[model samples]
Target: MPLANLLTSLSALPESGSRDAYLRFLKSAGDAALRRSGGPEHVTGSCFVFSPEFDRVLLCFHRKGQFWVQFGGHIESEDASVAEAAQREAREESGISDLVLLSPGIMDLDRHDLHAGFSCSAHWDVGFAAATAPDVEVSVSDESEDVRWFPINEMPIQVPAGFGARLERVRHAAMSQSGTQIG
Candidate 1:
């Protein structure tokens, strides 16, 4: 039911060119969109893990991409939904078990191309917002060289292009829903 869940989530998105692209990709690829073998272009689940106070966010130094990014990757066969996949990825990558979803649906969508040496041509990333206690301990996974929390106003310079703006939007959405003031 991952596909069905994804379709429902994507459908709930406000009308926009990005939403159109996601819908188009799902429509053409069908269930294959959830798997890597679907093609170079596939759906990915990611979470921007934040502190309970919303002042800091968790990012991993991806071993492959060699950059600090949110936790996420391909949607596996066992994933019940894209949100679940995002949560699972966050837990696995950050070693935090009690993260809570801040948004009811997908928080943002991103479509980006990979570098020449990577496996996929592009990733239509489905993003979610999640939070955990600020004092929780974190351990780096094998997929990352390092894992740590960064203040919302002081992200690393090595992040992907436009990551700052994307983070701001997700942060605002999460803050808005929880009735918390934006930091």
Candidate 2:
């Protein structure tokens, strides 16, 4: 049932290479892709958490990747939909439970190769955007060494490949979807 929800969500996204690829993966891998043990690639959910003002983005210094990145992880059986998975990850990793999804549909999709230390060779990441209240405190989860908010213009150097562009896309989507000014 959750996989069906994911499929519906992905299907609703506008046509794009990333969307196409995710559809293909789901068609071929079925529910297996939702689990980490699903071959070498699996679906994961992540969120670019923005401040109430939308000028700052929350990032975690991933312990394994050693880079500042958005909060996310593998989909679990408990997740009812991909967006819910993203929200769950954001809440767990950022320690901010009041995050609101910026869009009803996913904002971005990224398939990236993993480092050697990871169990999976790649992650087909479903990306979303969320906003948190001003002055909410963040506590770093066990997956990260640090969790902090950074200005949208001054992101940290140690980040995943293509993270800057990804953030820009997600930011635009978040702003437009939420009817917030793209300041």
Question: What global local distance difference test value does model 1 have?
Answer: 0.89
Model 2 lDDT per residue over 1-183, tens place: 867877888888788888888999999999899988878999999999998678999999999999999999988878887788899998999998777687758888999999987989999999999888657988989999999989999999999889999999999888888888876
Give every collision pair in model 2.
none
Candidate 1 per-residue C-alpha lDDT over 1-183 given as tens digits, one digit per residue, 9 for 90 to 100 = 888888988898899999998999999999988999999899999999988788999899999899999999888888888888888898999999777677658888999999976889999999999988767999999999999999999999899999999999999988888889864
Q: Model 1: runs farther than 4 Å from truth? A: none
Q: Which TM-score value belongs to model 1?
A: 0.96
Let me know the TM-score candidate 2 reaches against the reference structure: 0.95
The models' CA-based lDDT, in order, is 0.89, 0.89
Error of 2 at 87 (Å): 0.9
Kindly give the number of clashing pairs for every candidate. 0, 0
Lowest summed lDDT across 10 adjacent residues in model 1 is found at 97-106
